[model samples]
Target: MEDRRRLLKALAACAMPGVAGTALATPASAQPWPVKPIRMVVPFPAGSSPDLIARLLTEKLAAALGQAVVVENRPGAGGNIGTGMVARAAPDGYTLLLTINGPLVTAPTLSRHLGYDPVRQLAPVSLVATSPNVLVVDARLPVHDVREFVALARSRPGVLNYGSVGNGSAAHLAMEQLKAAAGIDLQHIPYPGFAQITTAMVGGQVQAGFMVPVIAMPLVTAGKLRIIAVTTSGRTSLLPAVPTVAESGYPGFEAISWQAVLAPAGTPAPVIDRLYRELVAIIGSEDVRAKMRAQYFVPAGTAPQSLRQTMASEKVRWDKVIRAAGVQPE
Candidate 1:
């Protein structure tokens, strides 16, 4: 009986460890993930489109997560500086990136020495929004529609010049795609930003180029510029009368600027899942939708996998466009 009692005591001690091990493996939800403030890095200037969207969404995300979500603008090197910062950040879900396709897709192909590989370094959380680019010409130009503009460009060849934010920018790529499809020769005049591009276009320094509706519509309405076509699959709500590039002639011409959220690679799956759910809810809310529409943006709260696929596909598409456009990085 003494020996049997000794064996029972040993078995009980072993069983206690198993029970403790199970407790230690408790689900991640029970753990306080974001016990403190979270930082959302926007790889653009403070008042830029990406920054504005980040500020809008962070307010709602903070409320949902019960923590402060701060927007830090670390703009430089065409958004690479902020992007690389997030890519190298700890994968504890404390730091997030709210960026556009430029850094993730085009810049990689344009720049030979980009510090971070977006697909390899960042885990996609969600696609926040997408906005179409409008092909607007100077009011003084004689073109009334896309066909007319193409004809005029063909007739003038390299004499007509178009402006873009810079080489390999979305505007630049869109125009390049257009040039390839329409088989016209137009000189590309790269500027520092959209403001400069718009200024040049309005001043008749350049003939035409692609621009977002928010910037181009005001000028178009003011009789400074004329939108020949929109570069999306469908017409934008902001300009219902404007035909899409596809509708104008080309079949598969779709160029759009998009914004998405991402976390450092190896971020805990539970945290990423939680963030995605909150982001989807926030994006679907009426207030967010209204605000997005007001800014001429189409709100798109897509799955993480969707964003990954989009990044992959865009990288391939832009590679071809950039090569065709003959845009070399500085």
Candidate 2:
């Protein structure tokens, strides 16, 4: 109360003609929100899919907000490191998070030591984009499709290894679910990020894994990697030629990966609302949608309530997958 009175007095004194230049500088509390550059934290390594998308989106967001929006990579712990950072950040709108499903929905069930509860600490803004993970193998593996790969894995058991960013990542859960469905066994290799996974696959450190289309397609095109099936129930336009795992042999199989914007829980409703509105507009724009689609992403400008529901449903879906794969919480 006293601070408020001081601010009013100072502001009023500034209005006086002769005192305008002499009055104390406006207090930070009196300044409008976004008075400075806003930091959009991406909890993944640079050049990762989320980083690519964040770079694309923050450019427009900065212009829209009339403030610079800088994307900072806080990669590690399958996105938990950066996610926990944002979860613990001050709820002042200056710090924001753009992340994927790992730290949001799956980690609670997959990781024994996950340090943050996304449900309790983060406020959903909107789901930014959605994409299916593509099942890809090193070109040397010689498996043509999901059936061939599963057969090989079933025969080889734990001999075949796959890589993912970390536990609770889309690749991790997707492969585990596929393994359980196919009754095959493959060893899991966790890397720090997809870039490392891609490198490892190219180097033949691992045999097969799931990847975003944007990252998998280039190598697939170059003959370094062979993409067989997508994790979606149906094929995506980015890889329309690629059949889905469900279409191959397994039924009712899906593992869709997505990105969403969020603020720390207890952030002002106005800030969340404004961010949501701006994100929806930017994502819904034809040009932005075109770019996202070209990159194999489908823009999902859902309402905050809708995103919350997505998180809830995904949590239920992955929980069962985790347990079925015998992934005990650490």
Candidate 3:
């Protein structure tokens, strides 16, 4: 309500004699926002899930905002380098970030030199989508489910290794939390991205991992990997046959993979509110929802407060797991 009022006041100021002229004389900066291309930064590799989703928004957002929404991939340091770039960018609403929870939640707890504080440096736009991670292992592994896998890892202890895209990634933290809950010891191997992790698992270099269904399904379909259980609190509809880690034995386990859009902190509340509304509408559209579901994501066009709440809860949840896992900051 306050933001709407402020926006209205700004517009009404234009009606005042000489205010419009003064705004014009002040330069383009004084003009209406989004007069030029807006950059949407994806702190992950091109063609990754976040990348694809960012592209999905670009087309519609360009039309909706009457500006080119260009996507720039700035992948490195577990999504920190690019994330930090957006965090430090001028809060003029021209730059934005479409990233996952690594930098937002887990990395803060796990990385010592992380340059950005997500809570203080970024403002929420909306929760784009959420997907449960699936625990999968190479087909040749003797484990059939989470129980057997736990037993196998327990039997081997530190000998069994798991792969993740990078330290503090959702897959990394999910497996770490599982290791804590299941009382098993597994080595952590960081890969470049989802594809590399899958390749390593298929080659038998790493025994298992927790990854989104989009990346795990094809390997499972080709009989190169076997599904164990999901990280969600309950069984997901996309893979109903697989039980959740919580149901398997641990009663309250839940590690969801989610993505969100954010801008530098101190961005105008009016701009933030406008972004939140537009993004929610874009994600809620039938075509967007259908494609999101096809990629195994549950569309979540939630409000800014909802996104902030989820981030806080996830930080608390992952903080305990990261500490328990004894993953030292790098």
Candidate 3 lDDT tens digits, 191-231:
76787788788888998998889888888999999998998
> Over the stretch 1-330, how does candidate 2's per-residue lDDT look in tens digits?
999999998777776755463444445326777889999999999989999899989999999999999999999989999999999999999999999998999888867778889999999999999999999999998689998998899889889889998888999999999988899989999998888998998888998999899888889889999999998887777778889999999999999999999999999998999999999999999999999999899888988889999999999988889988887665
Candidate achieving the largest TM-score: 2
Q: Lowest-scoring 10 consecutive residues by lDDT in candidate 2?
A: 21-30
Clashes of each: 0, 1, 0
**Model 3 off-target regions past 4 Å?**
1-29
Clashes by residue pair, model 1 = none
Alpha-carbon runs more than 4 Å astray in model 2: 1-29
Question: Cα deviation in Å at residue 257, candidate 3?
Answer: 0.9
Sequence-dependent TM-score of model 2: 0.91
TM, every model: 0.82, 0.91, 0.89
In candidate 2, which residue pairs get closer than 3 Å at backbone N, Cα or C atoms, i.e. clash?
112-330
Which portions of model 1 show Cα errors greater than 4 Å? 1-31, 151-161, 203-206, 324-330
Best-fitting candidate, scored by lDDT: 2
